[model samples]
Target chain A: MPINSKIVRRIGDLARIDLSITDVDMFSEQLGEIVDLMNQLDGVDTSSVQEMDSEIGNGHENRPKDIVNEGNCIELILKNAPETKEGFFTVKKVIE
Target chain B: MSDLASLTISKARDLLSTGEVSALELTEHYLQRIESSRNLNTFCFTATELALEKAKSCDRLMSSTDRGKLCGIPLAVKDIFCTQSLPTQAASKILEGFVPPYESTVTERLWKENAVLLGKLNMDEFAMGSSNETSVYGPAINPWQDPNEATPLSPGGSSGGSAAAVAADLCLAALGTDTGGSIRQPAAFNGVVGIKPTYGRCSRWGIIAFASSLDQAGPITKTVRDSAILLEIISGHDKKDSTSVRCEVPNFEAALNGDIRGKKIGIPKEYRIDDTPAEIIKLWEIGINQLSDSGAEIVDVSLPHTKYSLPTYYVLAPAEASSNLARYDGVKYGYRATLKDDEGINELYKRTRSEGFGDEVKRRIMVGTYVLSAGFYEAYYQKALKVRSLIKRDFREVFSKGVSAILTPTTPSPAFPLGSKNKKSPVEMYLNDIFTVPANLAGLPAVSIPTGITEKGLPLGLQIIGPAWEEANVLNIAHRLEKDSNFRIKPKQWWTS
Candidate 1:
């Protein structure tokens, strides 16, 4: 799992973080080292082990009744938005 | 009044009850201390007016029969926890100016207990780095320095400010989150007490999520008893966070009876890695002897999967962080990059994240994205999950063998100079969490108590880890160690000068 500049670029795109050529080269080298460190897991035999997704394994199914417990404060919800129009969070046009 | 800043929460509570010190007087003393100690860079935001208001209200209720447990105690929290109408930036540029409209459940609980807030402490951006250098506000310097040497040392990180502020007596205690070793490591570095309870002991709702499963809010305090008092207030089930366990919050402070008789304290041989400084090993031996002299039987145990904890944590935490951080695009809250007219939504996300995130945060996001990508998910993320299960099973085996708690050195070495390690490689910095990450993987309760000092006069800590939901047992063992070790060393208050 050698991370090259091309793979770093792809990862940057997937993560939606813009990276320059210098960042790509630097990340390729650094992430290569981190990946090498993570490669230690390949040596351990996990065949018989169950994958522990959450520390508290049994609590996922616990859900409260479906109801709108709290809402209706549009001002509070949009308070921190970078831009808001007509009480909705405004982003660059998704489709023009 | 100046000496009021040195009192622990327990002592302060007694003083408040006896009418010897009003809550307003205590709050004013800490506010003055925080104002004078600005050079340490511990507090990013100081809510002086709000703290005075809260303290006045607390003084009004001083004679009431029903009062909160932490009624007059002044404390600060890592900026990662949301404080409603106050700045809750997570110490990252991306979250700049993002004041959360609602309080985090943990902080809400603290308020319900009538604790005074001295505002938010600084931390690594998104709690990613081992040193506090990644904070947008700059690194929080450790108060402890070699008296002969002028070079400042690091307050081991992520929760660096929380630990440093408590060490410097800027606040009585501070709340810090431990995802890997964010709480314990800094506590070790600053020569204070910190505890990370079982994973679901405290609610995660309204906390700026780092790694959801691993992130837990705990207290960094001047004493083990203060840690227990704060932990009791913050622990319990909350409807807002489903992961918060539905269990009884024990009387943790009351459990500190200093009785460890017949308790089997485990010393896992696997923690003894080569190249560890002789001071750390020697401090660990002193801890073992202290516990043994206190009548607790020391047993040799094996947690063989311990070595894989750091690798597993690195894989899982970032994969979750990459997903959690995806919400910080330009659309909603926080910083948004200025875009050219032709740019669209994707460009908005890219530029905003690139400009907003720090280097270590970006590096983690990259590793997380790469690992969770289409082809590498099973090899990295899935394999790490199984190794996590093995690590949990290893702890379970030891605890099942009647081991009451496991004692280990909290960090590999004492605090170093601020910029010394992270320069060469990020992996060098990652090794600082080696001794503390295993408990997070297993989701157990662990505490760090300052028990020894390095030859350079920097403090070293010994960690006591207990079974899941057994924070009471863990605190009791630590309280015993704290009593036996009698560590009373405080950092020189050079910052105030």
Candidate 2:
């Protein structure tokens, strides 16, 4: 099935990236075939196969202990931010 | 040591231990080489000042018996690895001029071993492309060019810079991360050694995340033993990455005793697809005979789900990449787009991300978001995960039946001319990673060692994959094959002149 241009635009919005009309047209054509290729997975019967998360091996033994820890570099942490004011990240106001 | 620039880690070690060559002298030689070979565009950033200072320190420690194995050696770091106070852009406009205040665990360990930083090497934008064409800074040209045409051949990627630097002899060895065949495929194209150790073997702390599950760090070097030496230094447990396995690091170099006698090497029949080139199949057969001649028991194995690896990798890698790349908002680190009067927070995010990401990256994020969206999640993303399990089970069954390693071609064919393939869409590009994805999906160790040069006089690679955390056996098999094949096809030094 053709992945509709509307679906592509929705995905682009979901990903929070703006797309020109040209990109939507081009990407929808490409993504449609890629998603169709990915649909090949449906042919394989995986009824009893347990999903593997690479190294995790379907187990949670590697999870670190939960504890609060302080990082040493607050100034450095704020160093790369585009807008920082009074030691807090600043962004455009969400509420009027 | 007349030709200082071409020395390997093991060769350089022998000379350094005997006080034949000072570390400072070695660093200066490589710095000069990096500058002279500027035409290749292999090195995106280099630090002569920092390298010399560290080389002096390395020289001072040479007198002590407690010196580390990599003491006084110079290495190129991929831009994807965070080096404290140095630019680590991953060759993307989004991360242009972004310097981390801390070091990646892998790089920190290399520095602790007294390895000199030769500066950051070029790569695909966020490690995304099979060819190096997608890099924002421009492609890192493969040192090997076809004889007749001026058109540059690709070095393969996203570790293209690492491979080109090693093949060009810019550094002794380099570190590279492979999410899906980045290390191995690039190494194959460049005629060198590249290995991607099992996932959880190297800590992911400070390394830029492309795909969290498949991304792994390993070494790219000139020889198999050099790869073993570097791998031994870089692989181990780390508290910083929780997924890092807490096991004792093995002596990988010592394990390369050239002893693969009575070992079962699997040749997956599924790897021989109909469309695969005869030359590549011939090299695979040669690799089989070479190993079998060395007393390894060659067994025909079947990974029935092998054909679906590339499609599954595309789904899973992108899904994770969409999540990992979400942090790059204009409010945080790296490049931020200029806002217009009407733009608010949502607009800022949309514009910043749209401006920051390249075409390929944008394509992936959209594909990823589509799969994870509410309606299609069950049909695509969930289905891909289940298929991944079957691919892993294929390896488990073969390995459990006493197969020490699986031998196959590292890439479908030798290096094609850059821009010759992948002109229309990414399907042809993604297909290039077919043979090398199963090892990543299974979290197993895989290496690409040059087997022979092609009819076009380009390098080809044979891959050896071992079960999880059994890099020792895999390295041993590759080491034996290296000696048996004795395929030493070096690129003509056209770029250096």
Model 1 score (lDDT): 0.92
RMSD of each: 1.3, 1.3
Among residues 3 or more apart in sequence or in different chains, the pairs in candidate 1 whose N, CA or C atoms overlap within 3 Å are none
Give the lDDT of residue B394 in candidate 2: 88
The top-ranked prediction according to lDDT is: 1
**Model 1, residue B194: displacement in angstroms?**
0.2
For residues B1-497, could you state the per-residue lDDT of candidate 1 as single tens digits? 43797899999999998999999999999999999999999999999999999999999998887778889889999999999999999999999899889999999999998999998999999999888999999999999997666678889899999999999999999999999999999999999999999988899999999999899999999999999999999998888887888888999999999999999999999999997999999999999999999999999999999989999989999999999999989778999999999989889999999999998999999899988999999999999999999999999999999999999999999988888885637888998999999999988889999998999899999999999889999999999999999999998778895
Q: Compute each candidate's TM-score over C-alphas.
A: 0.98, 0.98
Give the Cα error of residue A83 in candidate 2, in Å. Answer: 2.5
Candidate 2 chain B has its poorest 10 consecutive residues by lDDT at B416-425
Off by over 4 Å in 1: A57-67
Q: How accurately is candidate 2 docked according to DockQ?
A: 0.69
Q: Report lDDT (Cα) of residue B37, candidate 2.
A: 90
Model 2: pairs clashing at backbone N, Cα or C within 3 Å: none
